[model samples]
Target: MLSLFTIISFVSIRLAMQHLTSLFKCQVFTALVCLLLMGLPGQSYAGKILVYPVDGSHWLNMNILLLELHKHGHELTVVRSSNSWYVPEQTKHYTSITIPTSHASNLEDPEYMAAFLKRNIEIRSRDRSLSSFVALQQQTLTLLMEAHNASAHMVRDILHNKELVKSLKNARYDMMLTDPGFAGGVVLGRYLELPMVFNVRWITNSEGHFAIAPSPLSYIPTIGSHVSDKMTFVNKLKNLLHYSIGQYIDHGITRPLYQGVISEFIDPNTNIYSLMQGADLWLMRVDFVFEFPRPTMPNVVYMGGFHCKPSKPLPPGLEEFMQSSGEHGVVIMSLGTLLGSLESEISEIIAAAFARLPQKVIWRHLGERPSAVGSNTLLVDWLPQNDLLGHPKTRAFVTHGGTNGIYEAIYHGVPMLGLPLIFDQFDNMVRLTSRGVAKVLEVTALDVDTFTQALRDILDKEKPYRENIRRMSQLHHDQPMKPLDTAIFWLEFVMRHKGAAHLRTESYKMPWYAYHNVDVLAFLLGSITAVALLFLLTCRGLCRVACRKRPRDKKTKDKVQ
Candidate 1:
């Protein structure tokens, strides 16, 4: 009896072991299936991506984009000028192709380019009154034509480069991501026959109410529009004339060179600004945190604070520097890329303003130090801007109101003292000032006292600027999805969808005047009047014939009688 019981127990144990083995196999199969499903190409990963940067600068806003692309598992390549200087932090992972650009014989270096631009601005300003505006427009046209020619040469060099052309020819990219400000990339994307995506790193025209190819904030001095935007009837008429003159320059001058020189790469019909409007998607680096309510397209995604990355511990020396700045907290002063390394007089004015301030100042001075340095002020050639802003001791920002800077300040919920130098800075400051989150200091007119007072006012604890900025910061932080994630999602979405053609707007199909439907009323009146005149003429001819025949009838009646 004992032997029989042992046998049964042994058999039971063996059966149970077999059952467990079968269960394990089933689970293993399920897991393999799951992995396959997860790894299968989603709708988003279908094509190659080409990213063209405006220039190689840390401020180009390409770093976060590259990171996002990596997370999505897509390949990207960048086309940049041979002379480009990209910061490692911004371009560590991406593969780049250097194209030869005949930008100008004079702008051989960045410093030279900076001085050249400044001189150009000064010359244009001086000639504004003395020169016939039309003559001035013609000169501007000549410059644009030259720029287009330069861009064309670069495009041809890129297309003809044996290895480069082979790579592009072999790679089946669905879309091209480009910053339209760069004439070369703008023209190149048009020829690629792939869908274009615009990353408006700065403010573009509020779509619909007006389609400014670039941002339209022109009230600020030094970089405002040469054209007028006055509201009066005469001013409106003058603006119309001005725009016509400007278009003449762009078309009669710039476009001709692009066609004659660069036409080989792009289709004859495809052009830069015109083709840009037909882009499959647009990512505007605009946050509701900084810019106010404005018209934007349904397809236009606002990914303003996309540049913010995971914060890391501050460097030991930097941490100590901040700690030494004391309890009131330190202020970050930067004039952004365009205004960096300004003239000595301008730098002195900035330094003098800082000397008056009581709070510790950390100025990102990219040039030589001022002759007089205050103990309270610390000058660094560069700082990890986003990291510094994210720091607790960062109390306020003194900026030139560049779009990126404004958005960064908003992301950190820091108040601003704006010194708008040019371009869309005026519009950016106007929005900030209206919101009471910033104070605008027009650099052309601001005195040291005015600048100091503005900074002081913003730094005051009770000031609404601080409170308002806090509110905006909360809103910025409380976003449904982080800007980077949103950017990645769309970028991936385009890859999966093979260019997101459904997102493209048809506004470009209409002519400039037709877009506004200005001719509709005239068309209706002309059609109606033409039909009425035809009917009137027919009736009048019939009446005249009857009148002449009546006399003949009377004569015939007399003969019959």
Candidate 2:
């Protein structure tokens, strides 16, 4: 084909040369060559992006995304609170746009997380008592109410800041990238009227899918349900109840959380749920390998392990420690960024459990050392989690089931022993456990023996966990393009095209009745009912006429006789 195309080009060049001098021939040939090369793609212009990131682990992943965009020559402006611990005010990758610190952003206060974890641990330790359960419910709701109210205040502050608002309006960013875990970013994005993209897993109310996609309660497990996609009758019943609870939170709590802010800042008539659902694109931090197979949308691009990369070099001492594990291999433990550390009793139990193991352990501890220290264990305030997970001598991961850590372990094909603390952590562990990969130990029931057994179970060569996780890893890595690249490509696509409205669903604009086609169903049912009634009435009238005719005919016959 190349030779044939070359011959054709030569013929065309020859035809032109016949009417030109030798000096002009070279110029004509070069001109034709240049025209042929025009089919190839050219460089695209850099786009301006406004980022409104959720702090903590949410910021961890969002920062990775923005950095990649920076590498691609895009300008970024990150909106943050003055008191935000996770989102720094100064960064070389993006310009800072700070708003006044308020109660809304303070829901992310570190002390709040510690107290939340402490309260949850205390409640979980109760012996199936009603008081414990009540306490759990009350604390959770109180915390949620506080968080939502705080976020609303954050939104209000952002809107009321005339200078900040004016700067943003003047910037005219191509897109607004945000985490929809809180409605602060979502509300601001709508007010800015930019092409919004959600770096999302959970929305303000529930998991992001529940907000926009078709989720069947019978199969798609709700948060904290501790059930899988495949459910027994009882599990289905439990899932339904959890779904109802989610709905209550969505309506009773989450909606009202943002209503006042929306009314004052955006439009009075705008529904917060509708505004959240109206994003042009959702860069979902999810993968089918890690998640249940559920319904999704066209504009939602799943990039679950986009933050994961090839393991860079581990520090010399860490590498030596990993090497010292020899044939037994090592175990790495982390509770994610949110939880500082477990209660002392739980830590001692974990330490004792690790002490019993022959394999070396590297624990990322945030508090005072436990008394039951193991000779083989090395405790650090922080470790290169991805590097350790991807290490050849690393046998297993002991994690709190944070999505980032889960994906990193998945990326490395390391089986996990999960000690889920709170929030979506328990549910995240359930998915992996159901897949025959990770083993989960309830934090409330954490004892030395149980933790030891679970750790050994995942590390056992005879166990299918290693094999199952390896298979899952292969599936994750088998993509045509790398997950991060795919994410950035689509994001840049949005910037290049201005917005992804063509891929977005207009179902967001439809009311609940119209979205579910309930109105259409009602009309069709009504039409059917009317047609059936009309048919019945016509039949009755015909029968009555026949009866009347028969009687008249009988009378006539009698008279004639």
Angstrom error of the Cα, residue 411, model 1: value is 0.4
lDDT of 1 by residue, 132-162 (tens): 4445444444544554466556776777777
Candidate 2, residues 1-561, lDDT tens digits: the string is 579889999999998778577658888999898887665433375789999888867888999999888887889999887778888888898999877755745445778788888888888887668788668767867777777787778778888888878988998899999988877888989999999999999876578898888999889998878899999999999888778777887888888888988888787877778998898999998999989999988999999999999899999999999999989999999988877579889899999999999999999998899999799999999999999999999999999999999999999999999988877998999999999999998888888888999888988999899999999999999999999999999888888888899988888889889998999999999999999999999999999999999999999999999
C-alpha lDDT (0 to 100) for residue 163 of candidate 1: 82
- Once fitted onto the true fold, the runs of candidate 2 whose alpha carbons sit more than 4 angstroms away are 1-43, 129-134, 535-561
How much lDDT does each candidate structure score?
A: 0.67, 0.88
Off by over 4 Å in 1: 1-47, 56-59, 87-92, 101-108, 116-147, 160-166, 201-249, 252-254, 510-523, 542-561
lDDT of 2: 0.88
TM-score of each: 0.79, 0.88
Scored by TM-score, the top model is: 2
Candidate RMSDs in order: 5.3, 7.6
Instruction: Write down the worst ten-residue block by lDDT for model 2.
Output: 36-45
